[model samples]
Target: MVALAKEKQKELVEAEKYVSEVYEAIKERNPHEVEFIQAVKEIFDSLVPVLAKHPKYIEHNILERIVDPERFISFRVSWVDDQGKVQVNRGYRVQFNSAIGPYKGGLRFHPSVTPSIIKFLGFEQIFKNSLTGQSIGGAKGGSDFDPKGKSDGEIMRFSQSFMAELGKYIGPDVDVPAGDIGVGAREIGYMFGQYKKMKGAYEAGVLTGKGVSFGGSLARTEATGYGLVYFVDEMLKHKGLSFKDQTVVVSGSGNVSIYAIEKAHELGATVVACSDSNGYIYDKEGIDLDTVKRLKEENSLRISEYVEEHPHAEYKEGCSEIWSIPCDIALPCATQNEIGEPSAKLLVANGVKAVGEGANMPSTLEAIDTFLENDVLFGPAKAANAGGVAVSSFEMAQNSSRVSWTFEEVDAKLKETMASIFTNSIKEAEEHGVPGNLVIGANIAGFKKVADAMIDQGVI
Candidate 1:
């Protein structure tokens, strides 16, 4: 195993040297774009065998072209607050890649939203969408607008203004945006209303994550979390384990983490920890799903409030410390790069059997390597958290067909989609002789499809 690992390391070094020119050029072209650079490095390091298999990709300059977004848009979103105060925020959209189908991704509305973060997310989306067996391409848009503590009117106004400029660039067949982080059903509704008002057409397919009363599909809210559990379940079953009676640690209290907790509990896994921006709560008896939902989803409170209801639970002051708690499974559902080498080491020391990323690139490269070296089952974000986007595509189909399927139907389809994703990732990994390494399997599998599609299209 040591010899094989050393050989793989040598291959990665050679791969880096092979792409050094283009990688360096990307850095010089886009200075200080750390997140985007990190994302590119991860996938580029995994493509040595791929480039060897398909020389046309390199000859056609697919890597260079794919690294640069087809289009980038930025604008100022101006709105009026409930107190009659004028406010302004920056909005950005990165139509990153569109080799397979129309651009599809999410719109995040948080203060941390930046062009670098959006570009990284958009880049990851390209491969993630590819792995889903869906025809959606990749794009991402968002704003530096913090919706926390804002009144419904304030959020609505902000959403309307954000969409006023964004609507011109997106359409049902062009780019479809869904919810991320701070953006949810409420924000999607406002944006959809603005898009309709601006375009003067009721194109429900233009945006997803809408209310079921309109065009939204059922189980969309639960897709990412549930999909993650489903994918991890596949990994566990392969390793002769299961979620039953397992202790889990889930970071974040957003829609993804909340439903992830619900599903993990349903599968008989005790989710012991969940966090938010302010801090994290550790419940020894397993988190009370109702208390968490009431505090986060219903009341929009910090995760620290979880300790108020559960006296036996403990609330840590910072979210970064949540990784120190012992658990069998660690699900990082928070933001990007939340788990670094330190956190990964802590989880490994505590005998974590698996790590499933519920957020985009939640684990750093070093952290992922640590987990892999320790024989931990690692489910990368592009494959695990794809449930939401899969369902978004389903919602798009429902909109196009002018029909809504029952919740059972949508949910059953989502389950199958997630299972198919797992099967494809595992199959591709084994076929490429990187058995059990879904990172390489997923990247290669997704890249082959898009690269072939791009080559066949004759260099647009």
Candidate 2:
């Protein structure tokens, strides 16, 4: 018994040391990529036990290969602004992995976009795509071109110029890109138009998030938000709880938050709060989704305007302070690292029962630790917010078949996919002796599939 105990202790130490070495190597290679390092460390930390259970991954150097992107394409995009002045911006497409299928991800067009941000998003996509049971691998592309105040013509010119170069690298079966933070229908339309003009063919599958009349999937806009709620609903149900009578706080007034608010209402929950970059609005009577849509999507205004219409509701000044409002659930739909350790602790104190990430890497590592340690039903972004890419893949299918499904059909499929993801995550968690730990469960489930595929393909 003493010998067995000593051997087990040695194994645990070895596993921890192995993962630490891999993580240190990653930091050394990408010395300045803090966000990318954070993402890698989070996923690697969960894989220690898995590595001990299956030494084959180590034998094949799967960790090393997966960390390094298969391809990183960067280019300069020069376009004529509305002022007739030529503006130049950096553009990138990191085809991180393609073992399962072709590269698949979104194209973010925000000023904060950098190589580190794109790399982090792409790395997360590898597993997010895997958990969906789809044949798509992982990739992410974007630019530092802020679309905030750009005119329609300026955006069109920028999109065209961006695609003129990006088109050389993507194809229907090669890689697919969709709308992300700043790239919406208008931007997608411009890019798709350019791609069509350059190829002299209508290859709709080359891109998702196209205008519905063109090739985009119905309910694509609502996929991420609604899927988030669906996944959370499952989580709540498993604990003999439901969304009924729950007060929810969802950050962001973008598509994800809006649709999430919609679905939560449908599920019998009152989403009292939603926010934008400037501030957040807390409506005790439940958020007015339609008014928010008009303010954000149509009028292009700040979230503070929500209070102008709803007199009873309060408008807070800080965006991060949304977590302090207290609720049964908290969905961070805004941006990366929005929820820090302090904010997470506040939520726990306020009695937040569940947290489903609608945005990628919204919570910092410490914040995530806080939630899990408190026994909060925390749904990691990769598993919780994968609905967008899953629906994007559905759009790819529709384009390939040259047929579009109805709204109800696509929505029903999204719900089913979300449920399956939940089931698989929990099953993997239980199997790995980390029952109820969705973070470990999701990471393991996603990593196993991709690792097996990479090993079979013989390390390209």
lDDT of 1 by residue, 1-460 (tens): 9998887777656555667778888889989889999999898877776775556777888889888999999999999998899999999999988889999999999998889999999999999999889999999989999998899999999999999899989999999999998899999999999999999999999999999999999999999999999999988998999999999999999889999999999999999999988888989998999999999888877888777778899998888999999999999999899999999999999999999999999999999999999999999999999999999999999999999999889888988988888888888888777899989888998888998888888877
Per-model CA lDDT versus the true structure? 0.91, 0.94
Position 357, candidate 1: lDDT: 94
Off by over 4 Å in 1: 1-16
What TM-score number comes out for model 1? 0.96
Model 2, 209-281: lDDT tens per residue? 9999998999999999999999999999999999999999999999999999999999899999999998999
Per-candidate RMSD vs. true structure?
2.9, 1.1
Pairs of residues clashing in candidate 1: none
Please, what's the RMSD in Å of model 1?
2.9
| Candidate 2 ranges with C-alpha deviation above 4 Å | 1-9
Quote model 2's TM-score.
0.98
The prediction achieving the highest TM-score against the true structure is 2
